[model samples]
Every structure is written in C-alpha cells, then in structure tokens.
Target: MVTSGRTRAVKLDSIAAGAVDLAREAAEETAGVLGVGEYLGAYAEAERVVSHHFACPHPGYRGWHWSVTLVRASRARVATVDEVVLLPGDDALTAQEWVPWADRVEPGDVGPGMLMPSPDNDPRLEPGYTGGESAADPEPAEASVIRAVVSELGLGRERVLTVEGRDEAAERWLAGPGGPDNQLSKAAPATCITCGFFVRLRGGLGREFGVCANAYSPSDAQVVSIDHGCGAHSSVPEPERAKELPPPVWDTIAWDETGGLFD
Candidate 1:
C-alpha cells in the first residue's frame, strides 16, 4: 500500500487500488470511535424482534434482514460502525428513519441485485453444455460499480492534486508537527449508501477527482447514472472549477497494452 510520503507519482488506477486498502483501515478506525459494539448489540435485538414479527418466507420471499457496515472504497476497508435494519419494503423509506445515515452509505452497497443465469446452468466443455458463468462475468467489480455510483450521486471521478504531490504535503501536515489540519492536506471520506460505510480518500489541487455530495442520502439512490447531470445535480461541482493540467506524461508513452476496460 502507498503511504503518505513517497516521492514517486502514483497512477490514478494504482492510487485508487491503494486507496481501497487505506480507506478500509480509516473506516475501521472511525467505526471504533463511533461505538460499533453498542450498535451491533441493538442491531441483533432488532433482528430478533423483526424476525419474530414476520416469519421468514421461503427462498426469495423471506423477510431477510441484514447488518450494515460502512465501507470506504478508496481504502477498500469496512467501517467499524454497524447499521442494522430490516430490509426495506417496496414503498419509499421514511426520511426520519434513514436520512441521518446519508453521510455513509451508497446504492452500490447493495451490489448487483441478483444473479442472472446465462443460456443454461450447465458446467461442461463442449456440445450443448457450457461452463456456468465466465470468469469475466463475476458478480460485480468494485471499479465498475464505483464508476456507476459516482455517476448516480453526481460526484466527480477526478480530484485535482497540488502540482507538488501528496507526500510533500503529508510530511509537512501529517508527519511533521500538526497533522492533517495543515493547509496542504486534502483528505475526505467517501461513504457508500447500500453498504453504510465511510472511507476517506486523498483529494486536493494535485489530484483532480469528482465530488458527489448529493449521493450522501438514501433518497439519492433513485438518481441513476443515466439521469445524472440534470437539475437535481445542484450540489455537484462544476468541472470548470478544477485546477487544469497538461495531459499526463504517461499518455504519450508507447503503449504495450491498453489498460482501458473495453477494447
């Protein structure tokens, strides 16, 4: 994992991967401070009460309940706080009951709704039978889902960094004397809804990324990626506000391979 003080410039994708690892730790730290133990105990009680009230039905019909954990995608860490609730019904959720958690959860937390089977459920090599699901079609990749989530929330995919770099800032702010509060430090947490977790990723003038503050609430889930950029995106920042830079030096490097998701 990349720490605060490395001199080398990390690629966005590489930094994203590293962010997942670091954010998880930060989330766990946050949870510990937020009193996860008390929350979990209450959550267990709620589960029992809810279960007793409505007997679980068969398979998909059952009233399934879940314990919620906050996850920070940047650091790929789960939050320490627990958000236990009875799975929501088809009707819209009450704001009083859920609005407070807007700071930590996101729609992507639910993951892909359900597994969709392909042509057949067979697992073989040839003729009529074929392998069940291809390796390429796994449940969901966090990277792709995150992109969708950002779109849905109207957050930016890019955060601008200082021309210098994060390490120099970290040394002055975090490592030197006064940590984080230093003017150069730009760290913010991104909370997912479906998962109910909050993780902090690095941000600032050097690294250009998006901010999707509108996505903090559960109601924001109704806003799909395709529908973003509409009037509803009032809280999203305009792209013109970001610090501009020349194209990455790497863009001109001879490409041995295409790192893009699609050919």
Candidate 2:
C-alpha cells in the first residue's frame, strides 16, 4: 500500500505524567490477573489524550503489549480511561499478511465440482479481436460485416492467452514428468520427436512440444516435450534371435570301441 506522504506533529501534554497510574490501573483491569506485566512507557496523541504501554505477560502474546488510552475533559486534573487493547510490538510473532482465496489458490486445488472464477482483469488473458463478451446489443451492418470478416480469419474466440500465459504454460510443461529432465526420459531408448505415436501440437508450441499417443507410455495422452521419451518409443531395439541347425546323427556305428555293455 502507498504511504500518505504527509506528516502531522503531536503536542505532548504534561498531564500525561499525572495519569500514568490511572492508565496502568485501566490496563490491569482490562487484562485481568496474569495478563498485564511491568510498565513500559507513555506517549501523547493530542492535547489531553495519552496512552500508556505495559508488557503482555501471556506466553502466547510474545512481543505484544497492552495499550491503555486515557482522556481528560476541560480543567480536569484527573484523566479517565478511554480504551484498553493489546497491540503488537516491533519484533512481535505475527502471521503472514492475509491473501484472498482466489489469489492464494494453486493448480489442482480446484477439483471436480469446484468452480474458481477468473477475474475479468486477469493478466493471463486478453481481449480477442471482437473485444470479448460485451453486454451491448449487436452493432450496425458495417460493424457486423467487419466482425464476420474477423471470424472468417479464425479469430472468433472471446479471449486469447496472453504472452505471459503462454510462457507460464510452456515452463510448467517443461518441468513436469513429461519433460526431458524426468527419470523416464533419462533412461529412454529414444526421444518422442522421432517416435511414431508422437502427435505434434499446433500453433506456436508445435516446435517444442507434442502429445504422447503411445498407449504403453506412462505419459500417454499427456503433453510431452520434443526431447522427452520412454521405453515405448516406436523404434526400440529387438532381442537377438537364437540360431537353428540340422539335427546331428548318433555315433552308434563307433560304439563298438567301448566294448562291454556294462562298461
């Protein structure tokens, strides 16, 4: 958030010294026993408004303090308590700044039956040639003719992916399991670019990515990079075939050299 760019001066009231005990009593009462600790300091907000700080003794509220604001009416020497509340200190343990559910959502967080609405001004998408989904009625004859011409040129979509969106998708695909860096690709027989089941994607992504049409591939039906591969590559090597020969004749004719049957 942007700063105010202006500063205001505060006048310290001498009466703050007289009301220190009163502010402490207010803070103690608001915090009850075991909440408030030793006195810290006091500061002035206006002519007769002052606030006193006391360390918070609760273990869960580390680096937090009790702030008791005191106010005085005209000609009154004694100040009465206005408000008492707990405030964080400079080095306090605090939670991260809150983020909207839409902004914090990650990929796959929206499952089936979930609808995550996209903001109209999202940077990832830009208006098509027709300027996308206007609530106004159809335009004049000349404008309709122009729109028809644009539609004939294949620009009929309401919104198109911006350069940032394209780049984001490309990077995500390249880092996923179907990318060249994954274990399957590292030990693959060959890359998908030369595989028979590799179906090249169209448009700007055609040169770098394709769909895996191989049923046996782990990444089947998924987008894979040009260099990504698996054992199911079309031209995997075949095992060596065993050789065959004619059956050999028995050496019965030479068996007489061995003599007796027992032998």
**lDDT values of the candidates?**
0.33, 0.84
* Model 1 worst lDDT run, 10 consecutive residues: 47-56
Q: Which candidate has the top score in lDDT?
A: 2
TM-score of candidate 1 versus the correct structure, residues matched by position: 0.12
Any runs in candidate 1 off by more than 4 Å, and if so which?
Answer: 1-147, 151-159, 179-263
Candidate 1 overall Cα lDDT vs. reference? 0.33
lDDT of 2 by residue, 1-263 (tens): 99997877676667864677888788878887657899888888787888889999888889999998888887987788889999999989999999988879998898989998768998889977762444123766666766677677667677888989888889999999989998899999889999999999977887899999988889999999999999999998787898896566875545555658787
Residue 246 in model 2: lDDT: 54
**Which candidate should be chosen as best, given TM-score against the real structure?**
2
Q: After superposition, how far is residue 79 of candidate 1 from its true place, in Å?
A: 88
Q: Write the per-residue lDDT of candidate 1 for residues 1-263, one digit (tens) a residue.
A: 86887555422233222333333343344334332221211112221121111112224433332334322244533323333334434443334644534354553454567443323322321132122233225365755665555556545323323334444544433333123332222222211211222122334411321222446433232212111122223333556766788788677776686678875
